[model samples]
Target: MYVVIFKAKVRQFDDQYSQTANRMRELALTEFGCLEFNAVTEGDLEIALSYWPSEEHIKAWKQHPEHLAAQQLGKQRWYESYSVEVVEIKRSYKSGSY
Candidate 1:
């Protein structure tokens, strides 16, 4: 498994941001093979974690047209700054099933 960590400094959000975000999440899960997606915001900070099966899937998602548009909008309006990190999960332990 792989995880993409997206940390952002929010500038502002509008209704379009919410709709686009939802659509993006759906598309990632349905079309890009995303295992899971989660996000949270507090104060001016936002963090999103998306799980994936492979780097190839992540690359395809990053270059997706709708995602590209959303990224442009985020840079122009929704976010002040952001960082993304992709990491491999080498091992795991779980106490219970979700």
Candidate 2:
């Protein structure tokens, strides 16, 4: 398994950002084989994490046309700065009462 962690310092977030985020989430889960996706924002900071089965899938998702456009928009208008890290998950565990 792999996890992609994205962190950003937001410059602005308008209705377009919200709508595009919702659409991208749907596209990622339904079309990009994203196993899990999570995002949070506080003040100017935003973080998003997504899990994937393989690096190929991650690369594919990164190159997706819609995602590419979003990236450009982030650079141009929405994000002041951002970083992405892709890590291999060697082990994972969860324990709780369902």
Candidate 3:
């Protein structure tokens, strides 16, 4: 499994951001083969983690038209700065199943 971690400093958020974010999450899961997606924000900081089966899926999601538009808007208005990291899972252990 692969994980994409997106950490950022938020700027502004409103209805449009909410709608786009939900839509993008759906697209990533249903269309791009994302295994799981989670995100959280506190104060001015935001962090999102998306799990994938392959890097190709992540690349495709990054280039998706709607996602590209959202990225542009993020840079223009939604986020102040961001960093993305892609990592491979080496091992995993879960204490409980949900």
Candidate 4:
């Protein structure tokens, strides 16, 4: 499994940002090989984590038109700065009740 971690320092988040975020999450889960998607915001910081089956899917997601637009918007308005990391998951363990 591959994990993509995205961290951003938010400059602003308006209604459009919220709509775009929700759309992207939905598209990723439905159209791509996205296993899990998670996001959280606190103060000026926002963090998102997504699990993918391979790097190809990540590349495809990056070049998706809607996502590209969102990236540009982030640069122009929503985010002050952002960083993304792709890492290989060596192992994972979980035991809980949902």
Instruction: List the pairs of residues colliding in candidate 2.
Output: none
List candidate 2 stretches off by more than 4 Å. none
Off by over 4 Å in 4: none
Note the clash tally of each candidate: 0, 0, 0, 0
Candidate 3 shows a clash count of 0
Q: What is the C-alpha local distance difference test score of each model?
A: 0.98, 0.95, 0.95, 0.96
lDDT of 1 by residue, 3-63 (tens): 9999999999999999999999999999999999999999999999999999999999999
- For candidate 2, lDDT tens digit of each residue in 1-98? 99999999999999999998998889889999999999999999999999999999999999999999998998999999999999999999889963
lDDT per residue as tens, model 4, 12-93: 9999999999999999999998999999999999999999999999999999999999999999999999999999999988
Model 3 global lDDT (CA atoms, 0 to 1): 0.95
In order of appearance, the predictions have TM-scores of 0.97, 0.96, 0.97, 0.97
Report the Cα lDDT for candidate 2: 0.95
* Candidate 3 lDDT tens digits, 1-98: 99999999999998999999999999999999999999999999999999999999999999999999999999999999999999999997888775
